[model samples]
Target: MEKPLMIALDFPDLDQVRQFLAQFEQTDQLTVKIGMELFYHYGPAVVTTIKQADCDIFLDLKLFDIPHTVEKAMEQLGALGVDYVTVHTLGGFQMLQAAKKGLSDGAKRAGLPKPHLLGVTELTSISEQVLKEQQNCRLDMNNQVVSLAKLAKDSGCDGVITSALELSDLVKSVGTDFEYVVPGIRMHQDAAGDQNRVATPKDARKDGASAIVVGRPITQSNDPEHTYQRYLKSWTLK
Candidate 1:
């Protein structure tokens, strides 16, 4: 299967990553996602070690901050040579522009291919009510995602990280230019965990997700390799 499976390595310890990869031994078939937990522990060494193993990686730090700060951080992160990285769409236009500039300059300096910069629209864990009451946003769930997705594209992002539930609409809004990297994909029978919105792997593919970010479903399963392969087969099917 040629579908990209970004295994969300949300594990806190680097050893857990090593154990998981050792057990699976299918690095070529799957890309790794280094989120807050793993990156905080092993830092760039985690990205470096995974690259040395010949596995594509997504640095899922979801960078957010002032324009210069986020830009500076991206400059340093680009040195790791991962396949992709993320920034929050809520960071606004100038911030996103700064990030793009940083990535371009850093990649040129390091003589490596530029990483795909994705924007995180809204985490699937948060609901529309919270976004309205707490975050003080009046936009409904779908509109909220659409608004941020447009902002991401206008700000020069290659893609946006959204839940599968809104991916189809986001695709319609943004057309074919921007990529929709959907997360919060769970099997029909699996527990939804912290995710408030989700779709099954097959549903996500059917909804036009360019890539699916799966975490606990495969990582926490007893037979992760089989589970992973099942998803790969499912995504490959026409």
Candidate 2:
């Protein structure tokens, strides 16, 4: 079975992605995330190139925009044949609905496979202090996260992007229909760096996250494969 983990190939260049992939075998069953840094650099063609090598792709553009614009963009992204895509839930109800509709429509028009559309709540980099002080949002961190997850689900998203710290409350509040794809995951031994709401792979799985996104913990390691395996093994344990 494929591991319930998607490695973020966050390289700014396609060459780096290629070099990393070359280290693994064809039948390795890895799902790769092409986030903004890589996507902005390589574009949709990079998606096609990676899939041709037999890896499922998660296109994490984290798009946030007006309803009409975001909807239209999702139409194009759906046509690219990615397995999953994301938008910011903070964009409001209209944008989320438009995105859902647009992706569905795109699937019908082009006979393309519809990707699982996820809503990004707060970024893992954001802190409760920032929400209260900088953004003037009064909700506590956990409450704010649950509120957004609920909105994202009500808005027709199939899943959410959040840290594992908030996963339990989200699952309790919203039920299991919405998949939780937790990012900001730091391996137990890894540096926390800029991420604030981080979790180890085991914790994320225990909290019922459907998938976890790991970037620097693996990519920046001296042994990328070994680091990836550490995440894989952690998730695989019963």
Candidate 3:
């Protein structure tokens, strides 16, 4: 998408999505994320609804399974013609390859442009403590994210969904050829909520993030359109 910010529509059902988007316009050229909750409940029909609004879609299911199974599922998702899709980078090289293949094959068959495949690295909600104790990894937070990012590139994925705090290392290690999408964004006044590695949109931009994902700050705002425009200005202004 031309815009660098994508809103995460974390709403539960189609009605809420329709209502939220009604505040904006087709000219907004908005890019939105349809996460597991929305997709799992509404299925592909939600994609059709989002499309009707003339916005770009990032289908963030973060698919992780056996290669063949993920591949088949991606075939269906690709046919929806969304702008981006995600798989877990921990799923390893062969699975990433299968995801790319499945998406391409499905898009080609349906005569649609293939969506970019982004691998989800360690989630921003995860802290170093969680990385060490819960996941039992020897490398520190940055190392693990970079490792997974390298694997994504080697596996032929287009980009990675990672945290803003880790962006500098990724840009250096993974380089400019890959897209670095940062989430868990929050303003200085906003509560951290469940996220541990949150950053402001300006921090993401200065760190060289290709895009940023914003949720509640915009979605739950009292005046969502005004809030969105504020964020858009913040994101674009130098």
Question: Which candidate leads the pack in lDDT?
Answer: 3
lDDT of each: 0.86, 0.87, 0.91
Better of 1 and 3 by lDDT: 3
Candidate 3: give the clashing pairs. none
**Candidate 1 ranges beyond 4 A from true positions:** none
- Give all TM-scores, in the order shown: 0.96, 0.96, 0.98
What tens-digit string does per-residue lDDT give for candidate 2 at 109-218?
A: 77887889999988898898898999799898889989998999999999999989999999899997779999988877799889999998899988889999998888
* Clash totals, every prediction: 0, 0, 0
lDDT of 3 by residue, 1-238 (tens): 5546899999998999989999886524899999999999989999998898888899999999999999998999889989999999999999999999999988888899999999999998899999999999999999999999999999999999999988999999999889998889888887777899999888888898888999998999988888878877777889
Error of 1 at 192 (Å): 0.6
lDDT of 1 by residue, 169-238 (tens): 8878898777888888887788999999988778888888888888898889898898888877676577
Which regions of candidate 3 fall more than 4 Å away from where they truly are?
Answer: none
Better of 1 and 3 by TM-score: 3
| Ranking 2 against 3 by lDDT, winner | 3
Q: How close is candidate 2 to the true structure, as a TM-score?
A: 0.96
Task: List the pairs of residues colliding in candidate 2.
Answer: none
RMSD of each: 1.2, 1.4, 1.0
TM-score-sorted candidate list, best first: 3, 1, 2
